[model samples]
Target: MKHVLVTGGAGFIGSHLADELLAQGYRVRVLDTLAAQVHGDGTRRPAYLHPNVELQVGDVCDKEAVVRALQGIDAVFHFAAAVGVGQSMYEIAHYTRTNNLGTAVLLEALIASPVAKLVVASSMSLYGEGLYRDGSGGVHGNCERTLAQLERDEWELRGADGGLLTPLPTPETKAPALASIYALGKYDQERMALITGRAYRMPTVALRFFNAYGPRQALSNPYTGLLAIFASRLLNDSPPRIFEDGLQQRDFVSVYDVVRCCRLALESPAADGEVFNVGSGQPLTVRDIALRLAQVMGKPHIEPEITQKYRVGDIRHCYADITKARKRLGFEPRVKLDDGMAELAAWLKDQAAVDRVAQASAELSARGLTV
Candidate 1:
């Protein structure tokens, strides 16, 4: 495809993907709503968005807007959605309308005017918790922590015998146990698009992205990436507030690597009708990252604050098993965590960072979303 359309293309990861497409000699069109929460109530286009991209100021739910954006598009990348776990629980209808309904509207439009390929953004959040293994090395995916368990300061998921389940790399085959509105909407978006694709014979790809981080992130928007949030806290002379003992494991992938995999999905025919996990196949604890980021950003004195308080939809540990992506898409994550964190730190030094997390946490607490 010579021309591609990226919904929510003006945001952090989307903007980077657009740049990659342009560098490969493809025309890029972007449809995005400059949501007040992320864009500071501004009507101006984000400076980070590539100059070559054709920007469309519109919502994904608007059929006419989406149709117009798809006029000359050969392929589509749906990345627009309300993306937060805690906030999604309280704003259920809004999340559903923006994410689930948005995908439905886009699919209907695609049915009217078919594209060569359709790629939808899914989330690892859908897997509520990652795969786990017992002492005998029996791998399992059935795991969940109760609010009562969390309330009692029990942060780990337990097996039937009450032994702690060891976290393992979560593969795409892991059964979804969506625990939040955000995760539910992402799963709905993925399933809806794939089902529609099969019924209509449209080539479709679903990508489950793990903790993606890099440049061009809006630090003011606390919900996007955790590293951005931590950086904001450190910049504001506050310790990074980590939940559930700060020992939780996650797969933090570079945005550059994510964009590369996205391009692979579009270019490689093997990726069609398949779901792949996009992440740096390594695991790091939340505490390890916070400390590394502090050291990288030259703020080693600011220790992370491990708040024993845990959110209702929060998971204990989850990282990606990128073997599927590696075999099918020939994907490899090139950026080392040290290198990516350094790059992020350098860019963040120039950008204005603010800490709105305390207030945001209070809002969640008020809504009883946090315990």
Candidate 2:
């Protein structure tokens, strides 16, 4: 069996990917700190306790730890990172060290190891302001404008002869401009991975994942996206709060789709040295997601109240141009938002039972009882 080394295998997306890898007859070795709380009781859960999985509780920043885990590894999926934007702003040093230094250490270790392919988890936030360039290597303000509109629209960039320039997507051709420290760190990681791959002539693919969500995601994670938080509040009959106008859209791809991309990147020879945007082409607003979750959970009439408190640096509208991924990796979304929401609701319902068990365990522990 092929040995796969997965960093951050305890986190939401990482755990799901580990599960899928193990199911496909791969010998999965997971290395994670298990810092994120998944259970209601705030205890760290080991991602892979199965006999086939080898779990190592360690930080990726440690070169020794990374090198040790890389032994006999055929490929490495580097998914470890300091995840939230707002949180990264507060804990700058923490985010920088974990995201940047950790990735460097992993790359150094991979250089020494026999690993043939390395897939790095990158973010779409590296694209600053969503400005697109034209085919003639000129920047344009309004990318969506047509040739006729470019002639008429004052926002267009004009040539010396006043001709219209054809706009291009923010493709892999353009260098990533970091908008935040988080984005900067992630971009740096991708740069390291790419440079390292070029040096060693090893396959490297960076996946800029969109908003991925599904079951087993921690409810206590305050930095999580609006979908899970809203779903949890609605499940508890509390009013779900929406930040800003609730009109900001996101390409919320299912966790399964993200996993599929990971699997594809592992198998496809054409995926090397490519950055693929892993997301559903469909974009949904915050309100749409809230309404969908409510409708799926048998609370159709419920509507989330919009709150004035807005997140800092929250982009108004951002989605992926997933056509490249579809063409290259043969990736397409398998689950619709409603269907995914229904699956999430069912999983959350099951969590209630685990919650009870946790509460009972806590009570027994408090009483100094073995039960």
Query: Best candidate, TM-score-wise?
Result: 1
Residues 229-296, candidate 2, lDDT per residue (tens digit)?
A: 77667766655666555765677888998998899998898899988988886768788888888877
* Pairs that collide, model 1: none
Clashes of each: 0, 0
Candidate 2 achieves a global lDDT of: 0.73
Off by over 4 Å in 2: 36-44, 47-51, 131-177, 352-371
Q: Looking at model 1, which ten-residue stretch has the lowest summed lDDT?
A: 34-43
